[model samples]
Target: MGARHEERRRQIAEALLAIIDLHGLDAVSLRDVAARAEVSLGAVQHYFRSKDEMLLFALDYISERGTERVRRSLGQGEQPPRAVLRDILAELVPADDQRRAELRIATAFTARSLVSPKLADHLRAGYDSLYDVLVLLIRHAQEADEMPAGLDPERTAAALFALAEGLGMQVLIGHRNPRTALAILDEHLDRLSTTAS
Candidate 1:
């Protein structure tokens, strides 16, 4: 019963995402989601009592999907720490149709977060989790001598996260291409390998 309930919620969230992909978030409505999901309007309301509740659930679902994709890409500890970090960071920049759609939704929610404290908190928590993971990866790289010995893990992680996000925005806006953004990230990662002055 629990699994069925969760699956139904996921189906509703996925329908919401599809709607956002095709028509933008502004086009979303309970009736539209119900139609997309092939379910009754009451069913959507049962899972998400309000528009705010539905949007929050959609954001969380997308975030979890992204995290899971990164986990799958990283696999089981075979890759080097720096490589894992690079791959995970690269995932933030959309390189295909699916990723682009995900980015669009994320951008929408981020803008909405500016006016909604609860949404802002959710975004902050997501960033914090990413920052923590990056810091740990940097520490591991330092310990393995893959990165410079004197670099501060936390600061470096923060900078890398900022760079990736900035590059992602640039790519999304067409100010930069995906290849260029990735090359810039690679350059930054290469610099980390050199001894700090």
Candidate 2:
């Protein structure tokens, strides 16, 4: 019963994600999501008490999916700090169909976060967690002399993260191609390497 219940919620969330992917975020309605999920409106409401609840689930679902992909990109065994950091940032950009869809949902939520306190809190926490990790990675690299000790970990992490997200947004709006965005990210990483003493 528990498994079935969880599966149903995930199913509805996936429908919501798909809707956000194809239609604008403003087009989202419980009725629309019910139609997309091939379930009754009551079914969605039963699983999620409110629209915000549904949206939160969709965010978590997609975030978990992206995390799984990132873990896979890291692969087995310990990789160099540069390799690990690069893989993490590279996965954040919309370099493939899956990532593009994920980014679409994420971008929509980012806008919606302004008015939805629940979503705003969730998004803020997620960003803070990722930022902390990035800062930690930079610190570790500096400790190992992989990155220059002169560079501040917090500032460098912010810059790299901002660059990756900006590139993802650009790709979504067609201002930049995925390949080009990734190339730019790689070039930035290379510059960091060259700066190391």
TM-score of each: 0.92, 0.86
Model 2 lDDT at residue 35: 89
In the predicted model 2, the residue pairs found to clash are none
- lDDT (CA) for every model shown? 0.87, 0.84
Best by lDDT: 1
Encode model 1's per-residue lDDT on 11-106: one tens digit a residue.
Answer: 998899999999988878999999989899999998777666777888788878887888898888777899889988998888877777888888
Model 2: lDDT of residue 155: 86
- Clash counts per candidate, in order, are 0, 0
What candidate 1 gets wrong by more than 4 Å, as runs, is none
Compared with the true structure, what per-residue lDDT tens digits does model 2 show for residues 118-167?
Answer: 89999999999999989998888888878888887888899999999899
Q: lDDT for model 2, on a 0 to 1 scale?
A: 0.84
